[model samples]
Target: MLSAGNPYVLPSVLVAAGAYLAATLLTDASLLVRIGLLAVLAGVVPIVLNRLLGGGSADEWRDDPIEDPGDGGADADESREA
Candidate 1:
């Protein structure tokens, strides 16, 4: 999910960083609390980014079906007969 081709990666990272900085600098939260905010943002930012980027399609994987070699096991059967 963190690959270079992923459109949401950069946005997620930036949002998570912003969230962390805001929680730390704008509030009087403790270290553990700020870390907890970061953790939650890390998990949720990607999902929110996905939705915002129009990546909510559930049938995306269906677009690419696995290719068959076209022999349908005939080559293996002929070799066995020999």
Candidate 2:
């Protein structure tokens, strides 16, 4: 069975397969129509689906980004001295 939460990989594969089919089967279509279809199929649609299905902000997937206080900047010392 296929897994569910993969927002990028599956859709991308489907788009690639669909592009191959379109290229082979859609020769009678206009160049402008083919370009537009390929743009949506390979670029735009998968991106939109990924964003819609990719739960949570990117920050939530990582450790907190706070810098260590001991990694002192000149500003830290300057403020203390002042």
Candidate 3:
């Protein structure tokens, strides 16, 4: 039921729950390992969600030529005056 823009929210919530469960249930593992696993889940979950949502690769915005001001080459005027 979640929208595409909010796809990562569910995964993030799940990761938090999983981390809490691991801490409570797995007493033998070191704290560092538990933290590392949580970190990996946090990083990977968003990427997977984004891919599933059909997000495009990041792109730089470029202005269209039609949107530019038609200044009529002011530098040419300056050179003529000089």
Candidate 4:
């Protein structure tokens, strides 16, 4: 049950950057105001991004299709013993 359509990395980075920008640009705003806006942004960004990104769960990655290649070892390792 692997997923091939959920590319959430970009959306997360974008949302985080947006939140950080929103927090950083409020230089004259009060501390409470800054905290509140940051809090709301932190809370809302993931939820929106999740919905926008198909809302898959950890289970969706259980059976990764790409096989592991043993730490990118050299061809010699293929014949060497442990």
Clashing residue pair totals per candidate (backbone < 3 A) = 0, 0, 0, 0
Query: Lowest-scoring 10 consecutive residues by lDDT in candidate 4?
Result: 1-10
Model 2 lDDT per residue over 1-82, tens place = 1224435546666876687577759677776776777666666666566677773444553576577666578778899998
Q: What does candidate 1's lDDT look like per residue over 1-82, in tens digits?
A: 3344456666767777898899888999999988877766666666666767766343565576577657867897898999
Best by TM-score: 1
lDDT of 4 at 73: 62
Candidate 4 displacement at residue 42 in angstroms: 3.3
Clashing pairs in 4: none
Which ten contiguous residues of candidate 2 have the minimum total lDDT? 1-10
Off by over 4 Å in 1: 47-82
Q: Name the better of 1 and 3 by lDDT.
A: 1
Off by over 4 Å in 4: 1-27, 68-82
TM-score of 1: 0.47
Tell me the TM-score of each prediction against the true structure. Answer: 0.47, 0.43, 0.43, 0.40
Q: Give the Cα lDDT of each candidate.
A: 0.70, 0.63, 0.63, 0.59
lDDT of 3 by residue, 1-82 (tens): 2333545756676876788577769777787877777766666666677668854333312233545446767766888998
lDDT of model number 1: 0.70
Instruction: Put down candidate 4 lDDT per residue, 1-82, tens digits, no spaces.
Output: 1223334545644665676677678567776766666555555555566666677755667678676677766665866965
